[model samples]
Target: MKVFSICHVSIVMLSIIIISTNLMIPFYTVVAAETNCSNGDIVIAQSRVGTLPSGIPSFSVEITNACARGCSISNLHLKCGMFASAVLVNPKIFKRQDVDDCLVNGGSPLAAGSTISFKYANSFQYPLSLASATCG
Candidate 1:
């Protein structure tokens, strides 16, 4: 009777472990998917190229999608305060929405490892910051 009871307890413990592990698999999967990318994965780099004909400083800006999991990012918004350029920057590439909000790529998706670059002339380089993005 004692040996039977011990075997039964061991079997019950093993079953409980297996069931719990199985239930946790989906939860872990969902969490991993959700964490694959974020706004931090978008990298912005700006460098002073040269002076424009108007004497304003020209800067080259490069925006890169650096998602580790090869995810795509879209609807990218940047924190650009009073963003303006003396030189023409295609509105389709970058445009201001509000006093401190600017949209990139006309709200289109930037594929993983892809980069979008543009030039702007301003008295000083505007500090562009990644404010928000959607990852897929």
Candidate 2:
């Protein structure tokens, strides 16, 4: 009876460890779900606007955490189908390409009120036609 109880406890603990690993993917330490940068969370989003092809404009965006607590931002992807738009216009624009880590000193974790920036360039022909952008 003692050996059976011990094995049962071990199995339960193993199951819990596996479950926690799966949960971490969604609730990991990058961007917590309860974290809202838009709703008065002492957060800020900014971008530097630039133009390409003399007619097309692009924005390099950044999201900063201004609060004391650490936050994770999961599912934080750029607008959908925006990559095709860049390919059609310039064939080289990427919305979420691996930017150089220089902004954060080669993967330095950002502290409270610290910022993370990403750069994306967009360009189109002289006559600009909407090519299905996910960003506003």
Candidate 3:
């Protein structure tokens, strides 16, 4: 009888600990689910080659939020699809005009019809064959 009582109490304590842990995790999951944004929200996206003040070759990519509601994007970067080694040489991130405002307000959570630009500095020349220059 003593052994059975101890075992039952141990199981009950373990169950309580598990339930308490599970309850604390809902805060983050709920916040994330509320801000869910799909790929279809981006309607206007474009990229162009630009030059910095010193005439260093640079690339600029922009994305606009076209959905009726707001969404969040943590970070966007350039990705080389094929022959990544030979594609870009010494690519470095640079600041653009309006991007600083976005970071000041919040990293993510872009309002509807708003646009964001990301810049990168590189010596890549124009007319280079690229598999796909995309921002994600």
Question: How much lDDT does each candidate structure score?
Answer: 0.79, 0.33, 0.37
What digit string (tens of lDDT, one per residue) describes model 1 on residues 1-136?
0010011111111222356556432221122333256666889999999997878899999999987767778788899999999988998999999988899999898988999999999999999997777766
Q: What is the Cα-based TM-score of model 1?
A: 0.73
Give the candidate number with the greatest lDDT: 1
Tens digits of lDDT, candidate 2, 30-114: 2212322222322334353767675566655454545443442222222223232332322122232332101121323334466
Can you give the TM-score per candidate against the true fold? 0.73, 0.32, 0.34
Prediction 3 TM-score vs. true: 0.34
Best by TM-score: 1
> Candidate 3: which stretches are off by over 4 Å?
1-36, 43-46, 52-55, 69-107, 125-136
Write one digit per residue (lDDT tens) for candidate 3, span 29-67: 121223334455554333557677776666654556564
Residue 91 accuracy (lDDT) in model 1: 85
Q: What C-alpha lDDT, on a 0 to 100 scale, does residue 136 get in candidate 1? A: 61
Ranking by TM-score: 1, 3, 2
Q: What is the TM-score (0 to 1) of candidate 2? A: 0.32
